[model samples]
Target: MMARTKGTANKASSQNENVVTLENPIKRGDTLIETITLIKPNAGTLRGVSLQDVATSDVNALIKVLPRMTYPSLTEHEVVNLELPDMIALAGQVIGFLSPTSVC
Candidate 1:
């Protein structure tokens, strides 16, 4: 059996997440958040959002889903303020998460 290190569990779980570096950082209270990790959202996060919409890069779908998926979670308002490039990047990541190839 392979030996498990202290962060083995965290490392395993991190495989299901992707870190996105923002070209335009978000200011939350006193902090500027330059990167956000997008977790491979469970079914609960997809509720009330359409898979087709997410695949199509629908703005409403992004607003509805991002806060549920992002680490340092974005509010709907923050999602709205994302730059066009950032939004495109986010949409692409979300689409990738839906792909069967994303599973180990």
Candidate 2:
């Protein structure tokens, strides 16, 4: 887990904050579809996974990171079973939702 930073938001900064809204909001009583896809890595390959590889990689780091955002709602088991393309799509949605200003 990453350490949380402490800071106070100024009135102006807080007031002018940009919020990203989801098109399909996750509401109460909604049942999300569960699906899984599997991929096998080739032997003796030096290539590492990339965004394009999201369609084929056996393990996606992005999928693991999503649980940190969804928490109890999205368990490790659910994340591990997620399809590569689906994981990539979710990651894009998360990034779009957060609209981070900078990265550490």
Candidate 3:
């Protein structure tokens, strides 16, 4: 195996801001970081998971919606499961999290 050159590491690090920084970062009051998961296009459509629905919920309710946004497809009684990728994108903004910011 080869070690990464110092120059290469610096260049890569500069390009990717998502990489954790070692220095002090700007802090905002009560700001929460959320991870937006990759959406599975193969999954079928499931409504009522949009950003509008999520934003209206109270903090506790929002907590419940958070897990479901990125959850994998599941089967119930042999029905094909659906993943909500679109909802992930929309809800990301509603919750003040950074979206993958890519259109699919």
Candidate 4:
């Protein structure tokens, strides 16, 4: 796992500010599919989650969304047992990414 931003450590910093800028811009057509394995927090045991499938071209939106997802709390049991809808619901609840986008 990556380290948390200094904004989270310092009291005076704003959490909403972008501290690290991306060197390359992720346009509307970029794609990334990562299969993240789950590990037990205390025991360091690897769970059976083989990588989840994610297909999205909205790179700009994903950058904002990915960081908010809960890391250590997600277990392999949750991923294997629950269906796609259930997983989506859980992710939305934990990450708060399901809010309606504003029309500009």
Q: By TM-score, who's the top model here?
A: 1
Overlapping backbone residue pairs in candidate 3 total 0
Best-to-worst order by TM-score is 1, 2, 3, 4
Which pairs of residues collide in candidate 3? none
lDDT of 3 by residue, 24-53 (tens): 212223432222232322112323344454
- Tell me the deviation in Å of residue 38 in model 4: 16
> What's the CA error at residue 73 for candidate 4, in Å?
1.4
- Tens digit per residue, CA lDDT, model 1, 10-100: 2114553366667787887767777777788898999998889988989999999999998778899999999998888778788888888
User: What's the candidate order when arranged by decreasing lDDT?
Assistant: 1, 2, 3, 4
Candidate 2 on 2-95: residue-level lDDT in tens? 3322123221134322121222323223443332111122321213434344334335644544444442245557666655555555555444
Worst window of 10 by summed lDDT in candidate 3 = 73-82
Name model 2 segments beyond 4 Å from true.
1-61, 98-104
Q: Could you estimate the TM-score for every candidate?
A: 0.80, 0.33, 0.23, 0.22
**Stretches of candidate 3 exceeding 4 Å from the true structure:** 1-35, 38-53, 71-104
Model 1 residue 12 CA deviation in Å = 18
How many angstroms is residue 58 displaced in model 1 relative to the true structure, after the best TM-score fit? 0.5
Model 1, clash count?
0
- Tell me which of candidates 1 and 4 scores higher on lDDT: 1
RMSD of 2: 12.7
Candidate 1 RMSD computed on C-alpha atoms after optimal superposition onto the true structure: 8.7
**lDDT on C-alpha atoms for all candidate structures:** 0.78, 0.39, 0.31, 0.28
